[model samples]
Target: MNLFELVEQLFEQYGYLVLLIGLPLDFIALPIPPGNSTLTYTGFLTYKGIVEMVPAFGSAFIGAAIGLTITYILGYKLGMPLIERYGKWLFIKPSLVEKTQVYYNKYGNKLLIICFFIPGVRQFIGCFIGMIRVPYRTVWIYGYTGVAAWVISFFSIGYIFGEQWQYILNVVEHYLKVIFICLACSFLILLVWNRVKREKAKKLSNATRNE
Candidate 1:
């Protein structure tokens, strides 16, 4: 099944169990939107009295922490060695991981906390933080902080609007579309600006060298 159907099925079949499991699994690099749809559904169910909000939010938070810890362990055990041994075979981009490490080194622990809200990279931030050798304590503090933020923000919003779960879902889908379009436009603009700047820089450098 496609992603939308799969998520809907998850909501229908597993509900709280899926949120508990999925939140962690997302941290492990599963391509699931655990941060958004899962939390939204969980909130809806909590309001429906099918699941208690505390258990739902707390379990999800714990699961996310465990998942991130496991990711760090796996990265520590295999991430570097795998790169050294076979990353070339896997179409891996070494610079992305390297840059991520550099950011951790320069910024300290804040980057980890910030990445949790970013849709795609949040999963990898855990692994990258470990591969970059940020202290485990720092990683946990930053990662868990993100989990707490997501759990509290989404779950609380859901609980408060339980009466309008379906309406909220519709609004969310609409917003997702808006978010995607805005991101696309932003990326295109950035790309164009970078290209123009690169060309200008190259001309200036060449002129300086000629003199």
Candidate 2:
């Protein structure tokens, strides 16, 4: 069977346990079924009376939290040394990690909320925050809220659309790609603007000193 068929079969057999266990595994970057697909499928199942709503939602939320928490803890304990050693395998470069740290420093933990809606970003935000040594309380507050909101929004899309939930997944993934592209462009623009501003300031300082 195909991946969707396999996921559906697993959910059929394992019910809430599949969600509870599977979501965290996804968050931890394991190669299980995609979490979005799983949540959407679970929501669809709820619409069909195959699974209860509350339990399904709870499992997704709790499982995501567990996974994110573990990633954060690992990042905190391991820090740059770990990333420097193994990050390349995950496509996590030191420069990317440094850029994330800079953004975190500027925006504080609130950025974590926005990160949730971004696909690849959500997976690494916890680890980046942990590596930066953000306080656990802040991480829990923003990170957990982000997870809850993200889970509910995606799950609701599936629940509402019923049989058409797969289309919603495609649309979301498309938008996430667009968002990342826009973010990359914006970051480049900001970098150029900052460099120009610094160069102008340096010239002015030097000219004034000579006067």
Best by lDDT: 2
| TM-score attained by model 1 | 0.67
Residue 207 alpha-carbon offset, candidate 2, angstroms: 2.9
Which stretches of model 2 miss by more than 4 angstroms? Answer: 83-100
Candidate 2 positional error at 142, Å: 1.2
lDDT tens digits, residues 3-56, model 2? 877877887788778877887787777738877777787788888887799988
Error of 2 at 92 (Å): 9.2
Q: Against the hidden reference, what TM-scores do the models get?
A: 0.67, 0.86
Full-model lDDT for every candidate: 0.71, 0.82
* Highest-TM-score candidate: 2
Clash totals, every prediction: 0, 0
How well is each residue in 107-191 modelled by candidate 1, as lDDT tens digits?
6476556556566666776667667677877766777887788677667656778767657766755765676567558656865
